[model samples]
Target: MPTAATVPYKPANRCIYLHGFASSPRSRKAVYLKDRFAKTGIKLEIPDLNQGDFTHLTLTRQITQTAALFNNFNIPITLIGSSFGGLTSAWLAEKYTQVQKLILLAPAFGFPSSWFHKFPQAELKQWQESGYKDIYHYGKDKLLPLHYEFLRDGNQYDTNKLKRSLPTIIIHGKNDDVVPIEVSHQYISSHSTAKLIALDSDHGLNDVQEIIWQEIQDFC
Candidate 1:
């Protein structure tokens, strides 16, 4: 319910940053933002959303937890969401008027339904019936259990309808195998207020950290 216009820009400068799924506030990007913005009085709000069994909650609940960070903050917010977090940012931006800008990095436009298709129908059905399944890998040894219904529910949110003409920057890796770069391109094509920056790396954009940071600074 906290609109962007009402959020106080205490210290008169700063922005909020959100981390991706299966990742904590201690992620590389989050740390980078915090360090980079500290000199400018810009604070980053990176919450931990991976404590419990993530697959048990619905996507709405997951999204709500992320959006709640903005509710009490008095400063102007510029949301930066990566991967699944990016999808969450789209929903938050649609509902909240307080978001000044949005930065999406290799965002999945929709759930990676195709990845599920690799499983046999019976296996997929069994996983769905169980309400949980290890769907993907996160980092080195982390396995991501996904709730199919949660993805189905999240897909209901139409990103196109949340048009606020807010400045949005999307940076995607050209060689991304997880969420194809084409998805970001399509999003930018449909949203007149959005811009796209393509990198030569993969989904993680691991090698181009400095360049990506530079782009973010320019946009903000």
Candidate 2:
């Protein structure tokens, strides 16, 4: 139940909220955190990773676009990312010294490798041969065409390379079906600065949002 007004803040500190894949700036968590930050006159930057085109979305494109936001500002930043965005934030923190802290929710660590098992071998081969696959976009509320390049580009980023020791907090649902809580467990085990909080909820984590917010407040 922590609000931005209750949390200590510095005028120059920057905070950006990154939504999950197939989601947008208008996502439930993004909007809720933005509103809470606004209560204390803090601006939370929520950029649409889709960039007006979800068809050709890739992890590289998202990382480049999100990193561009740090161009002119020399101030320390706090990144809050959910699902795939959590993966993005981790890379951003690795590449940029300006990112002082991170709050990750249900981070998709093993990503495409983790997801590939969900589809049959023939289905996966068909997606590669067909060049694109139909995916359910939660933000658009429809099945959209996503190119196979998403998998190829994602393979370029190895989570093993994320060795920076920036303070990080990962809140993952114990009952998450999409990305296993074991991913966070492995991440926290390797990074001494990282902490994992297992919540009693599912993947979407709508029920434990307030607890997540409280964790974020304390971590920040």
Q: Which has the greatest TM-score? A: 2
Q: Write the per-residue lDDT of candidate 1 for residues 29-114, one digit (tens) a residue.
A: 77777787776666676666654666654557757886676655455567788887887777777777666689998886756464
Model 1, residue 28: C-alpha shift (Å) = 2.6
Taken over the whole model, the C-alpha lDDT of each candidate is 0.72, 0.87
List TM-score per model, in order.
0.84, 0.93
The segments of candidate 2 whose C-alpha lies over 4 angstroms from its true place after superposition are 1-11
| TM-score, cand. 2 vs. native | 0.93
Model 2 agreement with the true structure over 18-117: per-residue lDDT tens digits: 8999999988888888988888688999999999999999999998999888764446788999999999999988877778889999999988788688
Error of 2 at 2 (Å): 32
Clashes of each: 3, 0
